[model samples]
Target: MEFDYTMTTIKPFDVAVLAVEEEIVKAGMRVLYVHDVQKSLVEKGFQRDQFKIVEFCNAKYANEFLNADIKIGLCMPCKINVYVKDGEAFISGMRPIVLSQFFPHADLGEMPKEIDQIIRNIIDNAK
Candidate 1:
């Protein structure tokens, strides 16, 4: 099964980052964190392309999945990444449905499919 959802954007890296955060909120998910991977690396005396990791979650959905199988906590708080590579900007995330394959014993019901669509929508709109 496809495990990732990715989209290339013509928007600048900074613009794509804001668009992603805005889309996440518009989709009714709360942004938990934004990790500036490149900044972190640069601060440590390294240089790399721009990259940001945005983490978000819908409380109700998270509760539902966790209740279904506590082990699902390992995947809690979904993430979408914004990055510049080879002069191109990209917005991407792991497909939520992939969790089903990772935890076959858990009954995810319709949550993964639902989340997968929301994430894909976010990436498309952000781009």
Candidate 2:
């Protein structure tokens, strides 16, 4: 199974990105970083435009999971990136289920479902 999923066909890339960020914050997650990719690339070495990545995380959830297994720091953080492609804004995130699979003995039984739903809600609201 794939770890990443994408939402396509969104209009006004900037608005869509903001909507997703709002939804994520409303769902009790913290916006850790919002990178304007175009500017970042230009700062680095690319000429791309209208691209951004929003990194988010819920402290409560992250702490709980981390306390359960310290080694899970390999995937300690979670993020969702919003970017433009073909003139449309799209959101993408890593599937928690796949990430959890990396630690089979960690007992992430209900956590994956909860995380997935939170991500889905953010994506749905973005649209």
Candidate 3:
């Protein structure tokens, strides 16, 4: 099975970042943090492609997963990344269904599929 979902666009990196943040909110999720990876690297005198990590979560989903298995917290607060590479901006996120493979004993039910669609929609909309 595919491990991730990604969309590429010619849009500027900054514009892509904003689009992702808005899309997360539009999906009824909260943005927990936006990590400016490029800036962090620049601070240490390294230059790199533009990159931002957008961390977000839907409280109900988070609670359900955690209550089912505390270990799910390791992947809590899904993340989408907007980054530039070879002159193209890309949006990518992990496929939630992969979690099932990682925790077969946990009763995640249909959540992974539900969340997978939501996350794919978020990335597609943003792109």
Q: In candidate 2, residue 5 scores what lDDT? A: 71
Residue pairs of candidate 3 with colliding backbone atoms: none
TM-score (C-alpha, index-matched) for candidate 1: 0.97
**TM, every model:** 0.97, 0.87, 0.97
On the 0 to 100 scale, the lDDT of residue 106 in model 1 is 86
Task: Say which candidate scores most in lDDT.
Answer: 1
The alpha-carbon deviation from the true structure for residue 91 of candidate 2, after best TM-score superposition, in angstroms, is: 1.0
Q: Write the per-residue lDDT of candidate 3 for residues 76-106, one digit (tens) a residue.
A: 8899999988888899999999999999999
lDDT of 2 by residue, 8-94 (tens): 844587778888888988999888888887997898888885777788888778887887788877774777777776666678888
Candidate 3 TM-score, true structure as reference = 0.97
Q: After aligning candidate 2 to the native by TM-score, how far in Å is the CA of 67 from where it should be?
A: 1.7
lDDT of each: 0.94, 0.79, 0.93
Candidate 1 lDDT by residue in tens digits, 1-127: 7889999999989999999999999999999999999999999999999999999999999999998899889887899999988999999999998988888998889999999999999999999
Query: What would you estimate as the lDDT of candidate 2?
Result: 0.79
Candidate 3 CA-lDDT value? 0.93
Off by over 4 Å in 2: none
